[model samples]
Target: MRQMAVIAPVAMVMVGGLSGCDAAQPTDSRFAPDYQGVETTLLDGDLVKFDVAMQGARGPVDVENYAECAAAQYALIRGYGFARHLRTNVYEEAGLWRGDAVYTISPALPRGVRTIDAEVVTASCVENGIPMV
Candidate 1:
């Protein structure tokens, strides 16, 4: 009976502690203005959507241009190599030559990591004969 009383309190405490933890806290992947390599162009910028797995927890994001969008994705993957968390394969569709770039990011991210900002190095389209976007 005495042991039961002690065990009850201990179990309650453990449960309480776990409930307080934010194992399921929502993550924000929205990027702020002034992001590197972000710009507006003729195509009006590419669209970025989170993969099915990444939809809720990690959130979704959109980019206006393909060059910056693709580079940002590349930088994000390369950046994650430093942290060594779970990874998602990102690939590009045919868009650059047409003055746009489309990419797919997937597999959701674990808790803790929220937004990833990647610098855009190449501007594939421009008014004066193909400047970077």
Candidate 2:
């Protein structure tokens, strides 16, 4: 009976600990992002350059994502179904973030690991409230 009593308390404590582990972490609700715009330049056939700017970005990743979303939408507008990521340069100055990215648009899946389906990426961008041009 004494062992049973001790085991009951221990089991209760373990269950409480496990329940706490599943608790949701707090997120910052002050995250307000402003997407400036995107400027696209055609370097050559199938090769395109995207310049994107934004404000209130959390980090370089946000700027890069803006450029990526632009590339994906551009590919779709050009009647291409796929875009291959080439490179992206991200920088922040004062309170503004900018990304200079290059991508290759193709009718079919391009020859690269960093490839994106235009339709899928554009859908995700729209769902995430990201602007594209």
Candidate 3:
């Protein structure tokens, strides 16, 4: 009975700790991204760039995924069915991690990071359970 009492408190503490984790996920594949906080820029031609704020407990991969989702959605909105991944800058500052991704949109998939099909890209986002712009 004494051992059970000690285990009960320990289990409660573990559950409480897990509940405090701040990781969040999209409700569905078609869910729009929380791009309200993301910054975007349009360079010369079809070059588009974005910087997304990494949420708590998110790492570089997560940031990359977020950027990719936004880029894909942006291209689709621009009437471009494809995009080429230019580059992504991942950095940390002030205890926050950020990802700056660049891509070029076109009617046909450009060279780089493989061909990006708008439909497949969006589907990939959905499969990955990431939000689109």
* TM-score of every model versus the real structure: 0.24, 0.79, 0.65
Candidate 3: lDDT of 23? Answer: 85
Per candidate, the number of residue pairs that clash is 6, 0, 0
**What digit string (tens of lDDT, one per residue) describes model 1 on residues 1-133?**
9999999999999999999998876877563322233332222122242221111111112222334344344434434211112233333233211223333222333234532234222222222121222
Off by over 4 Å in 3: 1-36
Model 1 lDDT, residue 125, Cα: 26
In candidate 3, the residue pairs with backbone N, CA or C atoms under 3 Å apart (3 or more residues apart, or in different chains) clash, namely none
lDDT tens digits by residue: candidate 2, 7-45: 999999999999888668788768679999999999999
Question: What is every candidate's alpha-carbon RMSD to the true fold?
Answer: 17.3, 4.4, 9.3
lDDT of 3 by residue, 1-133 (tens): 9999999999999999999998897565442333324677999789999888754424577778778888888889899999888888887676566888988889986776655787787889889777767
List the candidate numbers ranked by TM-score, top first.
2, 3, 1
User: What is candidate 1's CA lDDT for residue 110?
Assistant: 26
Compared with the true structure, the alpha-carbon lDDT of candidate 2 equals 0.95
